[model samples]
Target: MQQIDIDNHHLNFQLELQYARARQRQRRRNIILIVFAIMSIFYVFIQPNQYGNKQNQIQYSQTNGTNGAINITETNSTLLQIQKHFEILEKLLISQFQGKWTDTQLTSNELAEANFYKTSYQNRFQIQLHLKLIEGQFLEDYYNQFSFYLNSSQLVLPLEDNNFVFENVRGSYRRSSVYENDQSSLEIFANLTMRLNNINMDSDTQDDIGIELDVRYTLDSETFSFNCNLNIINIDSKAIIYSTIVSVLGVIQFISCLKLMKDFINENRMASQFSLIIFVFLMIYDGYLGIVHFFLALQSEYFLTPAFLELVLFFFLELKLAKHIWQERFINLQDNLNLRRELYRFHLKFYLLAIVVVLLLYYLIYYNVFLIAMNLYLLPQIIHVAYKGQYVEFDKIFVFGLLSTRLFIPIYYRGCPYNILHAQVSYLTVTIIILLFAAQVVLYYYQCKIGPRFFLPKWLRPKSHEYFIEQPIDGECAICISQLTEMPTESQLDNKFIAKIISQNQNKLMETPCGHHFHSICLTKWMNVKLNCPTCRSVLPPLI
Candidate 1:
């Protein structure tokens, strides 16, 4: 094809086009920022503030004249609230966790002495219990001689970061073991599990974080002790394996997405389907995983690297891949306004459905049901292939990566009893889960092979479209023939023929499915407005 004669075309047209596009992009960015700001304001105002009490923390600054701290009462008030909450927590824990834990039994002689002391003088009863508590794996805090800590769990200090925060609730209870030692006290241990809901494999109910504390206190001093020696159910060694798998998977995905993007960029004719449905699902998937990893990075021993990598991967995957596809495939399609809107709606609707509905159902329902929800992300891609009735080449690593990425959790959760994340599954449950995911993969395979409408009724099938793109042809464009064949301008002549050699060649051509050829540029413009052969009026097909 002949080169486009830059001299004949007004430079202003190119500059104006560039300027218009820049304006459009700027307008879009502004709208996005505005919407984001509004949403952020709404979230800030509407959402309950977890750090409200923290924000109310009292600051002591000296007054110039008096050389005394101002508003000392504010500091007192906060401290009082915290202390009250701690007292309440101590009481509640003591009630649930008695002094003589089932695991630690007193000798017959000791029990007799304790009972006798309780009958004679109730005050000595608590002192004996505190001694026993200390003997039974509880240790006095090195810094504070009066306070003690459980060997099993770390001390839960209010200032330290933790998953759950203890807050003040009204109406405290002073009930205790009725023994004495009012001067003694025990306090919060941080790395404690309250066992919100008993997680049983057979049970359909989900797990929750509950406050299961064993507290004991006298009238003067509240004593709170964690169940240390009883059962230290720390998360398993399998977590390291899980984190390792995640790291590997994240790296693979990162490389895969980068390679696919590179390939697509090199092959400028990007006429294959890039399913927004799958793309958005992946973004959501990565987003949630990234968030989970973020927390893990802070807390877990093995998760830091994977968590950081996953977060980086998600941003990279979404920002680069989504932007490229959006810019090249959607934004560049100048004439397909309705199709663009429809695709946008499709993308948005699925986004809402995936996040709100799928997540809600997954949480509300049984994991067995929701486990399949993870695998169902591919259904939209299937729909796209079906609607188009054309087998578009999809990224194999990406398709399989979805499967591999989801595999580790289900397998470890269901199969390994030692797994900290989830449970021991029945063979049937495992089979069902594997089959559900495998079914999606298999169905996708068939969709690619036998066409997406293999299972559909013949009447519902989309009409076959042959674009003759398999064999792109060559010739001059009829629609733009006058412009192409017009007399060469002085500027055009001056630019190319300076070497005194004829350099202009025929224009690049494209072919219709009906075997008619036209300039590639001209046909692209013509097809945008009218999907028909220019000479024979044969129907044209949609381009990806």
Candidate 2:
């Protein structure tokens, strides 16, 4: 009953050990699952804001008006009248330069003179026109000229009761007027005519001509104010191409945030999930900035905000994730003081400090500095650790991952002239992915391969024993196990029969490499081959 109880106890001990190991495995798996769930939740809840409905709000205020409606009326009508007159001047200049005939024919010298006049007029007119219209300066010189044209009936000025009108040489007309009451203001009427010029009239002839007039009146004074402008609307399609590229890259950046989370998982699941949450929030903020950019392209404000935010967030998350992964693999506070001492003595602090300095330099100056320093500092450590048989799997993976990253460097840094923003973001994303992948590979290898190799050197070698077996008179010597020997000790003689059998059977005696005697020869052989002192396989050297 006692024996059976002891056997059952031993069986239970083995089972308990197995259960503990299984539990540890389960715990690790759970940690991974928790991280994955967190990341998935972040993506689901935060990703939609990046791509859904966008809003644009525009607010404008006009000067020289009591009512908001009055402001719009005055501003739009004045701008339109000026635009019409500018168009007329431009057509007249083009016709005169090309010697196109209206009812009045011009002599060649007159045409040449008009051409010269047109060039000079356009040059000076554009400069003054920009100042007057854009700078909001309706100078007296400009207004008097419009008044002269209207007074001569070459151009008819509209009614001064807040109405504005423009008639083109093609007989098309645009009329706009505003009305105000004691309570509010309203647009009394607005009409515009657009005409298609006859191409067959003269292919080379310039036909469109008109006068631009700007008018203002003080309601209390009832005095008319006017300014003349030469309007030139030069529309180019190239600006649209640049805006479209920016918009497309913004969309791509939002999508890349989700991909970044996946890369985080491949790095270190637990810490990566935390980083993913932060990045998701950053993506939402960036998306908001993108929306602002789209709506307010004309303002050019808030342009740098998103880029600044992105750069900050990217750097922060990258460092945090790297630290997390590295800590898991290399840092162990609970390790023996002596072991830590040895590692420190090996200049681990120097390496770590170098890493920190490089990272800081990257943030302060240039990213390539970090890359160069990391390569220079880390490659030697990897080789050293690998040669020590530490974290073999991790070392192999790290080597490969680093190689891949180096290969990707050019790709990351290649700035596509047409897609500058996209290229920069892509470079950062790729860099983060490579770093995370390398870190993970190192962690996994350390956990499995390197950790197991950490055993005491003494346990791996052999020890010596002192006992020796006597040989039987009629049987064999234990050393040769073939030649018979007569030597026998008193105890051996007392158990001579058993001793003789043991000796003849080649079973007992041992000898150390130093010529010391022992009872177990096989054990001595094992000790010698393992580099322990069979009598001492120490630096004292083997004894013959």
Q: Quote each prediction's TM-score.
A: 0.46, 0.25
Q: Compared with the true structure, what per-residue lDDT tens digits does model 2 show for residues 1-544?
A: 9999999999899799879986896686567546644644444345432211223211111221212222123456755564444433333322221111111121111110112012122122220111111111221111011111110111234423222342221111112111211133222211112122322222323333223334343333343332332222211122244344444453344344334434546642233112222223233333333343333332222333333333333334333344453343333344557545754643464356546544554363224334433333233444333223222223332234223323332333332212212112133434554565466446444533433233335455234233344442343434433433333332332223333433553454544445544434333333322323334333212211
Candidate 1 residue-wise lDDT, 1-544, digit = tens: 1335564365667678879986896687567556644644454346443222444433211221222112223366555544443322222221112122321232211010000011112221110012122221111111111222221012133332122232211112221121222333433222233322232333322223133333332223534432422222333244577788878877777777777677667853242455655666666666666666545543244665565565555555555566555554443344657756856875677567667844764464335456555556667777866665444444576677643565665655555533443232334445666776677777877776555567799787656444323333334456766443332222232212221212222233456678676654455545543455787776677432
Cα deviation of 538 in candidate 1 (Å)? 12
Go through the candidates in order and give each one's C-alpha lDDT: 0.45, 0.33
Scored by TM-score, the top model is 1
Candidate 2, RMSD to the unseen true structure: 23.8
lDDT of 2 at 514: 57
